[model samples]
Target: MDAASSLGIDKIGFASAEPFTELKDILLRHREKGFESGFEEPDIEKRVNPELSFESPKSIISIAVAYPSKLPNPPRSEPGAYRGIISRSSWGSDYHDVLRDRLAKLEAFIAERVPDARLMSMVDTGVLVDRAVAERAGIGWSGKNCAVITPEWGSWVYLGDMITNIPFTPDTSIMDQCGDCTICIDACPTGALVGPGQLNSSRCISFITQTKGYIDDEYKRKIGNRIYGCDTCQIVCPKNKGMNWTHQPELQPDPEKVKPLLIPLLTMTNKEFKEQYGRIAASWRGKKPIQRNAIIALGNFRDQSAVPILSELLLADPRPEIRATCAWALGRIGGEEASSALNNAQAKEQEPAVRQDIEKAITAVSQSASR
Candidate 1:
């Protein structure tokens, strides 16, 4: 614990490296139901078995580093100047890098204590289910929203773990406190929270935002101003209320970068996107998804000021996804100019899918104008 605190880990707990049999069955069911986000490890056995990751693993060390939830003095988004939001998780420096560094330090500390200890550490990308480890290690109880709810930091902590050959004292699992609470499920705009503790990733706005191609029409409005990820579930969780940790300086968010102006994102070049969002975790999927979501957000805002830019994208953007999304946005922000842009795009669009989008957009704009 002393070593972990020195290494900047907010909390550390140990658990026996037992096979996660319960989790395996749950994951199999999750797959059968088509609820997975497709980012999970395909090999169920490999994910549940710690021995596969480390030779004769006896203990698992789960660490939690709390990140800031509240952005101090965040910039305001007004009528003509709307901004899109990245989730609180992606606001600061990339957490994968931050957690990995802390884990490396912890690994070194353990190595010094036991020179022959074999240790294998992993962050988010690792095959191990990080939350499962954290829960077993008594870092927190798994919440109804599918987040590990630590008492100190609520669900705002980043989780990572290390499997070791040493048999350390295990910690008791924390008691679940989310009984009878269904705020997260009710608050999900897309109905992604299928049930308490169960999520339908396909219907999730966060997952939809990360998708590279054109978003389905049904989910666009629900996505609102979220460009990268969604925080509705967490934000609504009672446990997370009044929880904001800003202890880590590197984890602090830059207000401008996190809550960026939506219209300007449409015009960003590849180089500009990299330079601006490179350090944030939201950049992992690249700029196309963010730009696509920005278009959707502008439409949701009905910001007529963005009509000009959306029109330009509709006419000039080479990517079919971008052009189609622009058409959809312009259709939502319906006006004579937006209607004209959609009509022009529909005439020139060669792609069957894009043409369909443009045609539908023209009809939508017409209907909105009628109302």
Candidate 2:
């Protein structure tokens, strides 16, 4: 325990590495309901059984490292110069790398003691369900929002786990403290939280923002100014109300990079995007999703100033998704310039999908003008 603290791991607990039989049933049901975000591991066995990660798994170690919730001196988003926000989960250096380094240190420490302690560590990308491991390890209780809420750090902690071939007494599981608390479910913008601890990830803004395609209009408008991820559920959770972790330097947010201006992101070259956002977790899907979300945000803002830039993208952008999203933004802005651009796109846009988008945008503008 002292060694983990020395290595800067916020919380650590152990649990029997028995196959998560209950979680397997739940996951299968979730798949049948089509609620998965497609980012999950397809093999349920790998996700539930630690033995799949390593032979002769005995116990699992779950760790949590809390991050900051509040963005100090956040950049203002006014009329013309609207900005987009990345969620706190994606704020600083990628949690995956940070947690992996901590896990590696812990693995080294364990090896020194046991000499034969076989270990495998995993962060978010690992096949194991991190929250499930955390629950079993007594790290925290799974909240109604599907976030593991710790009594000390609230739901602001990032989780990781290590599978080991050593017999360790398991920690007591934390009792669910979210009795009658539907705050997070009610606060979900897309109603992704269908029930307590049940998330329809397909409708989740966090998942939607990461998708590399044109989003449906309903979610696009709801996405508002969020570029990378959504924090509405966590932000509204009463348990997480006042929590703000800042001790970890690696998890601290760069205000400018996290809450960035929307205009500049639309035309960022791959090189520029890599230089600016390569280290952040949100950049995993590359710039296309973020840029596409930015266009939707500009449209949602209805900022007239963005019409020119959006118009150019509508006509000249190489990516069909970008051009199609630009069309939506232009129609949403709805003015002489925006309407003219959509009209021009209607003629020259060759892609069937893009053409449909332009026509819809033009019709939407016409409808708005009539109203």
Candidate 3:
């Protein structure tokens, strides 16, 4: 339960390790499955390294940490054409930190018994497909939303692995419970869930947050107000109903990050950005990607207050991506002040792309003012 609490998992689920006798057999079968055939081999080597030797790993243990919390909807938007927004994850600290710590503790406990055993741990590294291992360990099956869904904790959990040289007993595998239901795939806003189990990670908002560098206007306009990750499919999952997973007490955000206003995030210096978000998972993409997201969110908000911040960004920021985004946000605000600033900025801006963005802002602002 300590691990569950740390992971913000409402309830924890355990899967026994598979016996060493079966390890070689399973590994062989999974290797034969291969990627070229449109099937991903569940073998750790294929998942992590094409050349990993299976002879060394004696056993694999899988664990599930659940994170289920009902989100209280944000206050309603004021009148005008608008779009909806969603919270990243309602209950906890970033799952990566919470789960990794618990796995570290578990490794220590195992080391006490098997002194010379080698151990490895991973959480959402993408190299090892987590859901497959969880399913094999009987923790849960990969649900339609592509999340591991256990009967006890629903689908809001993180999966982790501990591969050790010491042998242990493995648990039975779980069966897929999704019976022809395509709600998760159908409900995706950007159609990222192209099929029942297929996800185009490139088109995912969660992926967008992690992707480095600037985003084009086409992608920016569609992201809405999501400044971090996206959770539309997870919320729509029928299995996620009423699972009050425990919240990670330690993952509380720096007040600045918990409720970040779009304006200040764009203006933050590398030093200020480090001071504010350095410890969090969101810092990986550095300040620019987040600033880009913030600009998009401000555009979606169409809040007049964002106009000055956008204006300041046009003149002061060094990144051309940010300047273009500032123009986009100003255009969305569409007021006399925003338009005049954009018009003036366009003349002085040297980058063709940025100048084009400024001209686009002038047109959108003029049109909005006319209406």
96-124 per-residue lDDT for model 1 (tens digits): 99999999999888899899999999998
The TM-scores of all predictions, comma-separated, are 0.98, 0.99, 0.81
Clashing pairs in 1: none
Positional deviation of residue 23's Cα in model 2 after best superposition, in angstroms: 0.7
lDDT of 2 by residue, 72-154 (tens): 89999998889999999999999999999999999998999999899989888899999999999999999999999999899
Highest lDDT: give the candidate number.
Answer: 2
The better-scoring model by lDDT among 1 and 2 is 2
Per-residue alpha-carbon lDDT of candidate 3 for residues 124-230, written as tens digits (9 for 90 to 100): 76444566667776888888777888888787676787666766666677788988999999887777776766676666677775566566666776788777777
Q: Model 3: what TM-score?
A: 0.81
Better structure of 1 and 3 per TM-score: 1
List the RMSD of every prediction in angstroms: 0.9, 0.9, 5.6
Error of 1 at 271 (Å): 1.2
Estimate the overall C-alpha local distance difference test score of candidate 3: 0.68
